[model samples]
Target chain A: MGEIVFQKPKSLCDVPLHYCPGCTHGIVHRLVAEAIDELGIEGQTIGVASVGCSVFTLLRA
Target chain B: MADKVLMKGNEAIAEAAIMAGCRFYFGYPITPQTEVAAYMAKRMPKIGGTFLQAESEIAAINMCIGVASTGKRVMTSSSSPGISLKEEGISYMAGCDLPALIVNVERGGPGLGGIQPSQSDYFQATRGGGHGDYHLFVVAPASVQEMVSLTAHAFNVAEKYRVPAMLLADGTLGQMMEPVSIEGITVEDHDKSWALTGTDCKRKHNIINSLSLLPEELEQWNLERYKRYEKIEAEEPMWEEYMMDDADVCVVAFGIASRVSRNAIKAARAQGIKVGMIRPITLWPFPKKPLLAAADKVKSFVTVELNMGQMVEDVELATRCKRPILMANRVGGCIPTPEQVLAQIVEANKLGGAQ
Candidate 1:
């Protein structure tokens, strides 16, 4: 491997995602994060995580 | 707005709720809607929000009620069976005029229905799932994209009307993956004037409850709530119409069923059958205006549902049967295919043409 690059989407927080393979949770997570980033409310915004497979990934928001 | 991402309906709802300023989430693990709870659990803590997985559906909804009482934006989600368990709390939330988002990723029926998509909850959702003469702001999303937008809209409607709002999605819509572009909203810019966060000189302590011993007082409360509903009916009705112009027949459906019906309409039209679709975005309001308008042009109407015929009754009430109305549906976690709906439309057209 030439190089390992890690770039996080501005919409997503620096948190590990726990969704299963082929899961849409990551996509939705990015959309929400992007919406927050576009709206420029990253600091003031708060999120509520649910209890399904995505529960462990809440820290990313 | 350009980049599109594929997502499930349940996950989309969680994303939309967060973007809509939902700071509190309380829910139990339930099939078809477990992703919503899981999404919240992982995200709430990092954002300084609260997410609690209650022991049961009842505990979940009541926890929602408690958080909502504090004037914090809150939400909960479940599938058919779990939603059934949360009915009492839902009714109480309505009685208290509390604003909160409740998503029901609907599955099959009267009991512990399977984890497949179904619209059997039409009566339960639109007729007030719990006991009482009250109604909720019920929105049915047909796609994963609509799921995100509608979930955000649900929060706005609930806050504006001071009522509980529900996103009624079926298993197909909940589980299907689709591209969605989230755009044009700021979570922090929402108005918090009506929140109950310990009044500071601008207002008195807000008491949110649903108990009134006096019959007269309760009656007055009901009347007031009805007035609010009337205002909503006049201002907040939402729906979508496809190919109604010069069509001889119309199919009325919502959620996943309506999506199939849309494809059915296209197929029928390709076969020289004049068919159209009327999809109600707001199920409680029932899109009476457009349905009544379509009734005038179409000779017959076909009501498609995942359940027996719950919304068909509303269709009949709206159209007043000036034209014949037929029902086509599936039950017990079954979903009617486009071919089934197309056949119904063809039969309706044949009958109308014969007459």
Candidate 2:
């Protein structure tokens, strides 16, 4: 079997992002999650979601 | 008894909180409470704890919320105006039922009032400060020893009840030095099964949030929270009564005002005026039963505060207005003198033909 190298980051929650269209929050959030996954810091990472469009970040943490 | 070491109240609270197992502290420096953050900043790094000086009180408290959501003990400290700035975050914590200790080393306020001691935040601390019908387990410490003890106690109480707790001290208690022993401070554990720990793709994910968009769901959340509050109010009211066995006038106070009231009570007793005092340790619960019971024996009540008669209203309500309630208050960062409180006690002693 082929190695599955392009799966979703384990740090990313299995939920849909609430970002509006054209918003780069999803991209940034995915990159942040990818970084956490790459760094193996998912269990210790705590995301502080502020007000505005990023408030839903905790939902996807 | 453990040996006591002299320490400032702010540093005592910080050290006691560390002893109480608070590993995460996020705060911004505000006068009268900067020592707490400074102490945490110095000690947390050495002890493998996290200490971050946030940009603002709002951000600091929100960071507390973040750590609290993960079931770790967290705290933030501020003075009056900074506490006001963090009110929104506090309300969110209340709504989310997150357990965290919020220390308010109060200064004068109505707007950046002064860096001096004041209890003007009485209503702010006791009445939930934020825009909601929620209550923070509010503990007021009058002395540096109580500052150390209550800092530990408040953290335990917050975790036990799954509610935010505030250590409501003023600039006087914050800066005052006294012999304090943190040896007996112990942290109690509670079930944090609902905390937002990562699932590791094993069990279901826990969502630590306060957003209930449906009106019915929101109402249920508030109702459930108030049910817990009702239990807290019943079981958690703490107070100290001095010379109340046979007294004509009852003085009600807390924090620095309570410390001053004690002196006045002693002087009033010396002069045969028969004055006693009820010092509320838990300000929110207000110790209504004791005040109400005292209303039957005392001729009147005198509430001394650093604010313009804030706690006097609670005294009246708690005592059911069965006796006349007088306010001996000073605003603008002024504390009431023992002589001034004694005068109010004498006046109260004369009410209802008690003199």
Predicted model with the maximum TM-score: 2
Best candidate, lDDT: 2
Model 1 - which docking category?
A: incorrect
* Cα lDDT of model 1 by residue, B1-355, tens digit: 5588988778888988888889899999878888998889888998888999999999999998878876678999999999899999999999988888889998887788688878888899999989898999999999888898888888888888888999999888888899987765444444556555653334443456566657998999999999999999999989988888878998998888888898899999999998888889999877899888887788899999998889999988898867888878999888888899999999999866322
Score residue B263 of candidate 1 by CA lDDT.
88
lDDT of 1: 0.84
TM-score attained by model 1: 0.82
Model 2 scores a C-alpha lDDT of 0.89
Q: Once superposed on the true structure, which residue ranges of model 2 sit more than 4 Å away at CA?
A: A1-61, B353-355
Give the alpha carbon lDDT tens digit for every residue of B1-355 in model 2: 8898999999998999999999999999989889999999999999999999998999999889889999999999999999999999999999899999999999998999999999999899999999888999999999999998898889888998999999999999999999988888887878998887875656666777777557898899999999999999999999999889998888899999988899999998999998888999999888999998998888888999999888888988898889888888888889999999899888887788332
Where does model 2 sit among the CAPRI classes? acceptable
Q: CA lDDT of each candidate?
A: 0.84, 0.89
